[model samples]
Target: MWPWEHVAVGYIAYSLLSRTVVARRPGVPELFAVLLGSLGPDLIDKPLAWGLGVLPGGYSLGHSVFFAVPLALAAVGVAALAGRGSTGVAFGLSYLLHLPADVYYFVVFGDPPAYGILFWPLVPAAGGSIRGDLLSEALRYFTTFLADVTTPEAVPFLVGEALLLATAAFLLWRDTAARRRGRPEATTR
Candidate 1:
């Protein structure tokens, strides 16, 4: 999978899962924030790698479960203060979505230089310790499919990924618009 692939998949997963995970919650904007947060780890890593010649941070502090813990706790505190359990839960779901995506990326693509929070406190204390091999095989299959269908180069991957991302972006825009119109259910806070 490529960046666009991950983005598109993550967007779809967030859109679909957010509904169930944050159902009956208020604040569509906050829900979007959470959904964006779900992609925060990779989002952070990508920009840093492109510009600073380093990671989103020096290490995994931004992507690790250790970091999300404080965020989750903070959100909990906010909800407690506001007396809004539903809001807390919805925000928490966004953080929850982040973990699985990180786990899958790590399991398949390898740890992001030095970060792994797939299992959270369960997986030691270093960047990411648990290892996986099946993901590579799957990547191979995906690459093979790409090769079989088109030229074996970056263009094929890039084009496909772009289309995927564009579609997801459109859907997200649509979902957002629908929410704004107040014609359908959307997180309001």
Candidate 2:
């Protein structure tokens, strides 16, 4: 999934979860935390793999359950100590969700679920290696993605992604507007 797609999925999930469970929307800080979490895995692994060739693929270390789980737990623990438990939860949930989202993306594209990406060193990602410097590689991938999405076969997926992104944007706007109105209950810290 693209960065925006990851953010959309994370925001939608976190928004619904906050509304349903806490009866409130996420606050600005929580939203920012979620954004960071949504992109954290890619931020870590991609640089190591594509930029520095330190990892075997773009799905090692940061994408692995072993590292992610521990990192999230540590983040939550540290945040709790500082009285920011909700922010930590937001970050952790979004970060964890990224793994499954990637797998789901593969499945949606008619490829088998790439669950091995979550296991990392235990079960290596199939046939991925260093491509190039991060900037060039990202641009190359984005170009390919643009071309792919323009194809007739990508219409259904594109439509679904559009709806998902629209929903997330609307909800975020609603939350922000409510906060601007000084409605204390509309915000969650």
Candidate 3:
């Protein structure tokens, strides 16, 4: 899945988890904080190649689990501090959720099958471009499979994304209503 898709799913997982586990203690920003934090490690590669005169792609330090994990943790920690315990926990969870997907994409499919146990030996040795056939296959299979099944597979994902967005919209509406009534987050709930 694309980074954006991961993020879209992450946001929903974050929101649903927030509502159930955190019981609305953490606001939407906290959940979103996690999604953004996880992307930080990979996003740098694009800038390095485009702006700072670096190679386009390789098994660089950024792709290293050592570097990415710590950075992602730091991002979540910062969000937690800024937002509070519930927010931080959600961000931290979301940040962690991105790893398996990243590993699958970068280590498993990104490498050639000929090589034996490369950078990430345990993984399947990821290879092929980001937009390559495998990704398309995975996308089509996953999405199609999801969109089928008695009712729909993508429905959960779609509904999850929509709910997250709806929460944000409600926040906006609440803010507007509050301003009109002269209060914020409204003590009245």
Candidate 4:
């Protein structure tokens, strides 16, 4: 999945979870933390793989559950100790969700879900890095997506993306409006 898709799915997950678990909505900082978590793997792995060629592929290191789980646990532990547990939860959830999202997309596209990526060095790395640098690879990916966007197989993905974006926008607008109205219960940092 793309970064925006990861973020969109993460936001949706966080919003739903917070609504169910917390009495109040999450603050802006918490939301940003979630978004950051959603992009965390790509931020780390992409630079190492595409920019420096330090790893075999773009799905090593940070993309692994072995790395992410312990790190997320540490985040939660530290935040709870520091009285910022919510932020840690937000971050942890977003980070963890990215893995499943990648798996989900693979299944949606008719490929077997890539459970191997989660284990990293325990499991062998997948072959084939994208050609060229990060910017070039992203451009190539987007171009390929555009070229394939009109096919029947792409419809579900396109619709899903649209819904995710629309829902996020609606939620953001509602939150902003409530904040602007001086609704203390709806206030977020």
Estimate, for each residue in 1-189, the C-alpha lDDT of model 2 and write its tens digit. Answer: 899989988888888888888787789878998999999999988888888888887888888999999988988888889998878878988999898998778876778988888997899853245656878777777897888888899999989998989999998998888788887365545
lDDT values of the candidates? 0.53, 0.85, 0.50, 0.79
lDDT digits (tens) for residues 1-189 of candidate 4? 888889888887877677667745666877788889999988877767776777877788888998999878888888889898888888998999998887667776678989888888898755336545877766776787687777888898889889988997777676557656776254355
* Top candidate by lDDT: 2
Model 3 stretches astray by more than 4 angstroms: 55-59, 80-83, 105-189
- lDDT tens readout by residue for model 1, 1-189: 344454566566556665567542235655554555555655554334333435322124445666776776787678868886545554565655565555554333323532444333444333222233334433555686567447544565457567867877886786767766774555444
Q: What is the lDDT of residue 96 in candidate 1?
A: 51
At residue 69, what lDDT does model 1 achieve?
68
RMSD of 3: 8.3
Q: Which portions of model 4 miss their true places by more than 4 Å?
A: 127-132, 184-189
Query: For model 2, where is the 10-residue window of minimal lDDT?
Result: 125-134
Error of 2 at 96 (Å): 0.5
Instruction: Give the clashing residue pairs of candidate 1, or none.
Output: 26-189, 27-187, 27-188, 27-189, 28-187, 28-188, 28-189, 30-189
Predicted structure 1, TM vs. truth: 0.48
lDDT of 3 at 136: 56
Over 80-145, each residue of candidate 3 has an lDDT whose tens digit, in order, gives 677665556655566555555555443323333332212332333232223224345345546854
